[model samples]
Target: MATGQDTLWEKFIQPLFGFLIDREALKELSDSIDWETESDRLKNPDLIYPEYYKSQNFHGIKGGYLNSSAAVTYDPITKHALPPNENWNREAVIKAVTGNPLKIIDLGCGTGSTTIMLKQAFPNAEVVGLDLSPQMLVMAEYKTQLERLNVQWLHGLAEATSFDDSEFDLVTASLLFHETPTAISQAVLKEGFRLLKPGGQVIILDGHQKTLRNTTWLTDIFEEPYIEEYAKGSVDAWLGKAGFTQVLTEDVWWTNQLSTGVKSISNL
Candidate 1:
């Protein structure tokens, strides 16, 4: 029953279109909407508590767009040729943590795509996905179940996580920083510092503020109002103040950026 269009969609069009739509639509929507007014509406209640999953809509268009867009770029074969930008940074995190990880936590693990990849990369590590959206977490759970993967899904927030101090071997985030407010962003960094064990790493994979200059027209067309703010934000400074050391920042293709730092073992 499958047709050429289906194959093409599966192979190329879907991923490309999803990617374009995600970047473009998110930027436009963020710019047009008053985030302060919509913050409550956007917050998924199921995320605030685990018992409310029935109210979530896992297949909504926006959720679909996010899941598909993220998954497409996560596929190593497709991602390398297309260069989802964070490929190297992702690899770096995996290599650094996988060596002796007993457990790993992925904050803002949307649809668990990145979490799934991390699980595949290090099957020995017990991987957990934490997201504030129950809809996204549901999709992630479904996908992981279908794939027969063993991953723990938790409803949580990055700004104020439920995990105890030094609970994880590594704390990683992908494409999450730019979406939050400045204060919340700082809280996320501090939370990462608090949750990670001594000598553990906090690897961030997101858009590079500096690289925004190179894609001015694209950014404008994409309708990203926060793009400028994110470009001007001081993520590195916040991380440094949070007490992380050996900070490394790099720009990747597809406009993604990497920031890696080590938590001081002595502080723990």
Candidate 2:
């Protein structure tokens, strides 16, 4: 189902990023990073992530998120790749969240966009960004430091986190579900259910599903292997099955869909 553009990004753009990556600089980043502060960074745990996530050269980035340079360049590349949107970071969905959430966890938070935005909206809320890649966490952490934000980054898998049950008031994931396989997506939904306090909400912001999307060019342009399956799948049903209530989905800025739901009060 890949198009000519997909072939181009895979053949040219990906290799170009590899040439641009600085291996020497990346190797040195680990020396000063304090992995244990606030965030749980289990650097080399006995856990396993999906093979696609671990192996793919996502978004034509070299070494994927494993490369610190990829982390350094991911935001700029994606921003340029996306069409103009007034809700740049999908702030509308974030604003629509009803809870006066005091703690938030953003799963698969690449570069901490959703995580930081959540913290910016709720300054007093304890916010955490969790991702499987250390390099991505480094970029997220560096951004947090620059902004002097009280956001913490965790290096861990989204499907299975070390966080305790009902540890958060809200769980958010942006552009994550589409990249993951359906099984992994199911696991992440279950994990979201586990991580939320009773009545806590889960918000998933991702590529516009075919249900609401007019074009498939973005998927072709980016070579998203899982987009076809994701667009066809029902995250809303998954949420309900995971013991969520009042599940809803709405079209958001550009080609993104926002699915939000609450855990039942009875679960409390």
Candidate 3:
């Protein structure tokens, strides 16, 4: 994601929200974490960041997700950011889930919000949360620790994960596609297809494209680089292009939408 420093979000809104958060406690938490050790534990040494990701500023943050501040402020800002409600927006993903999957992966799982929810939804499932930012993964691990949920967090890319083919029963991403270029988002869907077992499913929860195209100011509130491009495309089209069957996309909470598709039983 990229944004101008002079944008409305950067000029006023982000600062206002920053003032509202408990900075003292956030600093304390940041100081407490052994960033080096934690990052080393979660990061994949062989992983390489793409130019689009490594070079851009996300959410008006200078270092994007790689910054520790992005991790610290993510949950609080996200709670109020989602329309109607944050948990409600995320729960739409859970509601869209089709089966009791034994293995699950949440791509671009920043701070493990929806990832944790997935674990709670299916306590027995082996859940994993993967992101490009090790800083975000540290916060994700901390959040899961507070929840007492055993979720595996990994530092990796959504479009090119290290996981084997036909390994997962479910693959999901929440509010992730809008942050990346359309080509990367499409590639991620294709990667999801490769990761799923024959007859498994992929679900995506993201902004309602129709709503976004109509409501420009909604996106203007934040410095979203690819949101406009993302809004112009269709998740259904992407899923179908990735060779998923039974594709469906439905509006959720007016602002968000859930799109789902299943791999063919004979896709092995």
Candidate 4:
């Protein structure tokens, strides 16, 4: 599915890792998985991918999340990318939760890393991790299987999910906004607002806008097409526009930020 276009990951990091790690072992590991069959089981055949998602290469991968290669390689690159530590970065999302949420959903949940953490933190909650990429969902399912975690991995769009309105007690998105266009990001926030029940909270973990704005190199280091725009915008303002109350945005580590908002209890 690669378009033969070189990305920063492909041009630099991948080659560096290949030099240091066992490429044959990695390839053998990739080949060992039944990618097609596994992915097909999680795929929503009726879902149509948007032009915004399909047109661009992500993380130097030609087909972006749609490709099996992206799912295979995401965790390795992510471990190096997240500052402090990947687990610490993701744990911030779990720590942001307020009350005991019975129903939770993670939008754009890549490979179920953070999603798994959510389940671990709130074991009694019903956790659902949804992503547009079936390949990514396959990896997520595999991970949950390993942990014996009761989590649902769905192939669906973040901006528009199939679930009923006001269903979830909590909604979370980690490192998802920067990869999407600003408008789409806004729409996703609105969708999160719609999905949450009255008095429910929505948590977003992504790049620190101010840090990214001040440091051009951070955005430049990755092949993220929309990060520059994401850095320029305000998630606080977006949450306000989406009809959320008690909104707050706080810095996490040096490069990331966590934004949270609650739906009004009076909505009922």
Alpha-carbon RMSD, each predicted model: 10.6, 4.6, 1.6, 2.5
Q: Residue by residue across 1-268, what tens digits does model 3's lDDT show?
A: 2356578787877888878788899899999999888888888899888988888777787878887889989998888788789999999889888879999999999999999999999999999999999999999999999989999998899999889999999999999999999999999999999999998989999999999999988777777778999999999999999999999999898889999999998655
lDDT of 4 by residue, 1-268 (tens): 2224474556777787667566676578679889989888889999999998988878777788998888878887788778789999999998899999999999999999999999999999999999999999888887888899999999999999988999999999999999999999999999999999999999999999999899876665577778888989999999999999999999898799999999997654
Error of 2 at 110 (Å): 1.1
Model 2 TM-score on a 0 to 1 scale: 0.83
Please write out the lDDT profile of model 2 over residues 76-112, one tens digit for every residue: 5665554465247568557768868999999999888
Q: What overall lDDT, based on C-alpha atoms, would model 4 receive against the true structure?
A: 0.88
Instruction: Show the colliding residue pairs in model 4.
Output: none
Model 4, position 37: C-alpha lDDT score: 93
User: What TM-score does each of the candidates earn?
Assistant: 0.68, 0.83, 0.95, 0.94
Clashes in model 2: which pairs? Answer: 208-255
Candidate 4: worst-modelled 10 consecutive residues by lDDT = 1-10
**Ranking of predictions according to lDDT:** 3, 4, 2, 1
Taken over the whole model, the C-alpha lDDT of each candidate is 0.64, 0.76, 0.91, 0.88
Which ranges in model 3 have alpha carbons more than 4 Å from their true place?
Answer: 266-268
Candidate 1 lDDT, tens digit per residue, 2-101? 2323343455645755665555654553455343333344444555442222332221223322233333333322343324443564665565453476
Ranking of candidates on TM-score, top first: 3, 4, 2, 1
